[model samples]
Target: MTTDENLGKAAIFDLDGTLLDSMGVWDQIDAAFLAKRGITVPDDYMETVTAMQFREIARYTIDRFDLDDTEDGLMAEWDRMAHDAYTSIVQPKAHALDYLRYLKATGARLAVATTMPAGLRAPALGHAGMLDLFDAIVGVDDVGRGKEHPDIYLEAAARVGVPAHAATVFEDLLAGVQSAAGAGMHVWGVYDESSAQSWPAIQSIAQGVLDDFAQAPRPLA
Candidate 1:
């Protein structure tokens, strides 16, 4: 499919695992955080928190590890650990910036539907040279829930001046794909090692599947 087939549509992207190759930041944080308590990061930890909001992740962490930390305390610690990486180390996924530009040039409205806050997400996308291209950026905080709900995707499309059905969401997690598709939008699953285990499940439900942004729609012109 090409942009010619979906002109003027909004392209909503999930930041951490979809448009940006930044899931490693969380993995590093998880290992370091758990190691401080003399525990090793479990294999299922990342998968469990991949679709959760920061508060949810923190709460889950405290309960799972029997840690004596409140959600706020854990979240603050994570923010401190992640600030430097998001500001400097995180980068756009392969061909992602080019694909965003391609969509823009073809008159597709762009938006980010992410769990990352403005401070972190903005700099990361700016560093990747595509921050200014997005017409809107919405987060789970903006919707009061995680990607398990379609609220964020709906808000992003509305902010970009498109109806849900006219928007296409690019996501790396099955939860995100399911939520956006359930909202009556087109959902394309983007490849990310963090969600590799769900790739088959994602492929089954998503309207499309992409190895990278290169496989996404483009302008024939």
Candidate 2:
């Protein structure tokens, strides 16, 4: 755990798996997409795209399946599918709302930096009853790059009117954590047992690993 002072800290969160229990939606989408085409994806399909950008996942699926649709069409289809699924099944992660409220009550600036399109992120946040919680909501379009690049977190900090070094990023995917860490923010890696086993360099990059946000330690005075 990081003993470094947490003064002037802002908290930026990755939306999907970190704040919402929605990682399984991706696997369901992949399975349904492949089954519609009469091809079966490998069991590790979700692992292959664990932290992938939406466009990257669409491209990979297109190439792997020899999909006849244009990249634009494929992305549209997937986006629509995800939106539908979110409306129907997605739920906030355990203690997610409570954590956000706690941050607000403690005067920690809150923001969401996600690879998901704003169209999706906006409604999902509202659906989860968290739309008013964030000071800023940043999507891939705001950064022009995905989480693989550190620009996303950097831009997120900028939007939140904070410097990267003073931010704490809550991330579920290793790639997202790496991006935040690369941008000089302290990360809190939220573990999902179904998706990931271990992150070796977490001790170096993250403030701590949390099974849920409620486990985050109180800020040091």
- Give a tens-digit lDDT track for model 2, residues 1-221: 22334446788888878898888887788788788989897877776766666777778878877888777787787788899878768999888898777777777778888877666987789889999989888876676777777887887778878788878888877777777887778888887754465455554567788877789756611
Displacement of residue 54 (Cα, Å) in model 2 is 1.9
Which residue runs of candidate 2 sit more than 4 Å off their true CA positions? 1-7, 200-204
Question: Considering only N, C-alpha and C atoms within 3 Å, which residue pairs clash in candidate 1?
Answer: none
Give the TM-score (vs. native) of candidate 1. 0.93
Q: Write the per-residue lDDT of candidate 1 for residues 1-221, one digit (tens) a residue.
A: 24454476889999998888999888999999999999999999988887888788888999999999899888888888888898788888889998888887777889999988656777788788988999998989888899999999999999989999888899999999999989999889999999999999999999878887778865421
How many Å off is the CA of 143 in candidate 2? 1.6
lDDT top scorer: 1
lDDT of each: 0.86, 0.77
Candidate topping TM-score: 1
